[model samples]
Target: MSLTLSLQRSLQQTPARTATIFGTRRRSFREHGDRVARLAAALRSQGLQANDRVGILAHNSDRFLECIMGVWWAGGVLNPVNIRWSVPEIVYSLDDCDTRILIVDKAFAALAPRIGATARHAPLFVYADDGAAPPGMLSFEDLMEQHEPVEDAGRSGNDLACIMYTGGTTGHPKGVMQSHMNLWSAATMRLSETPILRGSTSLHVVPLFHIAGLGRVVMQSIAGECQAVLPGFDAGAVLEIIERERITDTVMVPTMIQAVLNHPDFDQRDLSSWRRLGYGASPSASVMVEQAVQKLPNVELSHAYGLTEACPVISSSGPAHHSEDARKSGLSRSAGHPAFGVLVRIVDAGGREVPRGVVGEITARGPNIMLGYWNKPEETAKALRDGWLFTGDGGYLDADGNLFIVDRIKDMIVSGGENIYSAEVENAIAQHPAVAMCAVIGIPHEKWGEAVHAVVVCKPGAELDEEAVRTHCRERIAGYKCPKTVAFRDALPLSSAGKILKRDLREPFWAHRGSA
Candidate 1:
């Protein structure tokens, strides 16, 4: 069915109930639904035809949620801009998808002019920030005020819903085309596995551009509960919000969980209201999990494992897997069993199904799987083979069908819960004037799960330092994707065919730890 059906149900059943909380501002479902409908009418007035792509460049907010619903309500595909992306990266996505209108907040309003100048067609901008609309742009509030509420477009099934861009293996981001059914299946699948409590208020700290964060938003929408919105993550703010808002449910990456526990005011806060805590996006350390269990004794801790192509949930480990005995047996570290209605398999290089307990590429089949990569048939073909999405992660299934992620077959790094492809970083490093050749790899990091490390061989007569390398990369890519540490090398280890041996480069760092 259509995602808008949830909004309709909320309006009919719980119209007066609080739907969103942002700072001191609150909106009931009736208010939220009205705004969403008006926003939809405004989008149609702006020439948003059925299935047309609309982009949103902003931090997480109530307005962002409304914009997402509004676009879908108007039967348009969403292109949620990644806040971490550089101007070039942002422009590439807009141009690649031909997004005709961009809804931007004050944080990214400055980049609009450059993006407008660069994209194939300059998009009409709708300012969604707190202040007055900037020059030559329409105000978000004015649009809702001017347009009357319209009926939902009722798009469903295989109709495209979102084109979420993820870090690409070949250095440019690939837009993953998710259908309405895919998103619906993803949210419902999670609901079947772990039902949300009635009237539960969930907190939003993660970026809405990511699948995990947006998936939670959709789940909350369907559950018709309250959502406490935040622009971004801050440990102190998170603690204060949870205690202030009485948030009952929330999810975050392991890094965020660790930060919240490590906060100076952790023990002083009244986090007793929080009942369920979900952690994922990166592997969690047992020490962090133990600290969470010990500190928040009443809360339930769960973990999920998936990728963008799966609309993001392939497997989830519930509270049972986080039990004391499970932790001692290392079952807590497993990604848990396959999600309901999902088919997971560990396959060999030739796409042959490998026996359980044998490490291989993780492939998943389900209705939640994305339609395909936007306009990249070859890449899509390689990813979706024989109705199964061949996830580039190397993992194995235990006897109980629990997935254990060992290594990433793709040249990628997950730093602070954000995916950073090594090729993207290496492409930036090789552009440096003093670099002859370079390779990037993930190294063990205490704070971030993994840090981007660059191994470089500068030209024989030229010179380069860590700062120079980092500075150069920062100019080309997002700051997080840049190398956290750079090492000078006479030459990198290579295989027989002259390919750089990245495994050898990562050996010393991961040897004692046992995995990358």
Candidate 2:
């Protein structure tokens, strides 16, 4: 079955159920289906071909979900533009993908003309805001109003469902191809019929452009549950929505969760409806995890581990994963076992599986694995081989099979011919009293191949001295693993998912040097 079939199934099973809640607006499955069918017919009559990429450049709304279903119903692939990107960045993505249509909303209506200017192929532009089709633009409602509610396009499994553009940390963003089956499998990994997930009203604050946000959409659509979507994450806004909507389950990266927990109105908001809170992106600190559990004892904590290429859900530590021993013994740092239907193994450079508990590249094999990079055969070849996607992550599995991801493969610092995993050093530094967050990178040195350098964001009202940090690490890790130079910042640049943008951190220092 395809994503289209799933949507059709939900529409048939629960016609009256509230499918989407965007601010005060709500749409039931039956209503959503009708709108989507009309829009799909509109798109098809406008010459939208099977697998042609249609772009969406806006925030969360009922219209966002509508556009998604409309695209699938019309047998088109989705190319969601990054909201954080600059005009040129967005333009570059649209140009690179050759997207023939763009669906935008009221929030980004101003940038519509600008995005249109740089689009090389000059695709059709549709506004989700007003039915009025602007000069040189098509109206979203016009599509729905014009087309007939015909049968589904019947795009089957393995068909290109989306071309998700990865934010270019190194350079231009590249589209990652994902099939309907790939996404379906990833959804099963978390929101399956497990008693832990059923009957939960999922809150979506993350932007739809990112995999994590889209991941929430996947879960909600399959489970046939209600989604309370916030246009963008505002601390007060999120808190108010939770209490007002009686949201039951939500997922976010640690950064957003930290902000929500630190919000002044957090206690004032009635969050008793929340039962399970899933956090990921960057691993949570022991202290932060402890505080969350203490503050929200009624909520079960789950963590997911995934990259954009993996249909984004690789493995998850579910509600049942939390244990008193794990919290006390600090074993909660582990990312937990491989996701169901996903085969994970640590492999060496030659693609041979390494011994358990050995640090090597993480490889994942599943239907959830992405088809490949869009239109780039060589790059696709590098990623997908023998049905195994070689994930460029450095991690290990314990004898008990709990996988622990340390850092990116490129982030490992090789100094004096010894491999020093940056995450190990960063974790050590993070444990210091003064360090709020830290990223360790290698800097060129004449004597060693690279020297361990620490860029730390110090905690509020705390003083961090290089000597104190170095001394603290010497006690816990190898002496050579300690940072030779510590640089202080108010905060480290992070991705929307809260993962430290190590490439951004390292580029300033290493860009002029010969090697990474």
Candidate 3:
């Protein structure tokens, strides 16, 4: 069945059950279903048609969740704008996908005019804030009040569900086309592997724009579980919610988990209701994992590894892998075996499967694999070959089938749950008039797992400093994509072919890092 059908099924079976909680706002399944239907009707009233793209630029809230369901319900594709991206990045995605309608919250209201000015086809702005609509924007509540509930559009199977834009190696963003079946399969496969607990109440603090966060939402909906969403992450706030709301399940990146654990009130909170803690987007430090195990001994920990193109669940290391014996055996560091219904292989450049324990590019074939890259025939051909989605990740699988990540073949850095491509950062840095050349690389970071670091060679007699280079990048890209550390260099190490040798550049910083 489709995502729309799943929501309807929840409404039919658990109409009176609490569906969502955002701050003091609580919605029962029946109320949420009615709201979703009205929102779908509202979208149609605002010129949305079958397969039209609708954008949402907001923080994690119940309204954000509603917008996601509403898009699918109205037979429109979703383009959830990355909350951390700069205005230019957001506008690029909207323009690239030709999104015609955008929903903005109070947090992003100021960016609405800029986006409208830059986008080729200015989107109809709908303010998702609880208060009155801002100037030149339609009120979300008003639309709901004016429109009557509408029937589901009944789109399912291979129909496009979302166009998730991911960082590109070519210094641009590529929209990964996720079909309804892809997302459905991903959520089902994950549930098969790790069944959801009955009466589960999940805390959603991770940004819904990311695959990890959206995947959780889909999974929770399928299971008819209640979700309590936070607008953004705050360590103390999460602890308080877990205690007060009796949150049982939640997903977070390692950096966020570390921050929560480091908070002074962590031990003072009553977190006994937190039964499951899923972490991903980057590997967790062994020290942090150990501390979590020590402090929250009863909580089951899991880690997943996937890319947006895979509809995001390729493999998951479950609680068993986080056990003391498994940790001692170093299995906790593995990305784990392929998820149910997913086939994973390590293949060489020619697409031939490699021998076990041999490092090669990770390739996956599954119903969860994305349709293709939007408006990028060349990239689609390159990534999807012979029915296999070639993930540009360097990894090896042991005889026991546990996947061990070695490095990134595409030079992508995941810092604080955000993907930052070296090419993007380098492109921004090179735009500085004083910069002659620059290469960006991922370096080990204690809190973020990996940080974007840049090594630059300035032009002769050109005055440039680390702050100058960083400031220039911030103006071009998101702050998170900017290099956290800058090192000036006379020249970069190059291969015989005149190509920059990134391995050589990364060696010094990662030389001491032991196998995870």
TM-scores of all predicted structures: 0.82, 0.94, 0.81
Give each model's whole-structure lDDT: 0.88, 0.82, 0.87
Question: Which digits, one per residue and each the tens of the lDDT, describe model 1 over residues 1-516?
Answer: 688889999999999999999999999999999999999999999899999999999989999999989999999999998887788889999999999999999988998889989888999999998879999899999998999999999999999999999854346899999999999999999999899989899998888888888899889999999999988888999999999999998998765786688788999999989999998755424556787999999999999988889989999999999999999898997889999999999999999999989878899999999999999999899999999999988888998888987656755688899877675677578667687667789999999989999999886689889999999999989999999999998977743212366777887998899674
Which candidate, 1 or 3, has the higher lDDT? 1
Q: TM-score of the candidate numbered 2?
A: 0.94
Residue 328 of model 1, lDDT score = 80
Best candidate, TM-score-wise? 2
Clashing pairs in 2: none
lDDT of 3 at 2: 92
| Ten residues in sequence with the least summed lDDT for candidate 1 | 492-501
User: Which candidate leads the pack in lDDT?
Assistant: 1
- Give the candidates in order of TM-score, highest first: 2, 1, 3
Better of 1 and 2 by lDDT: 1
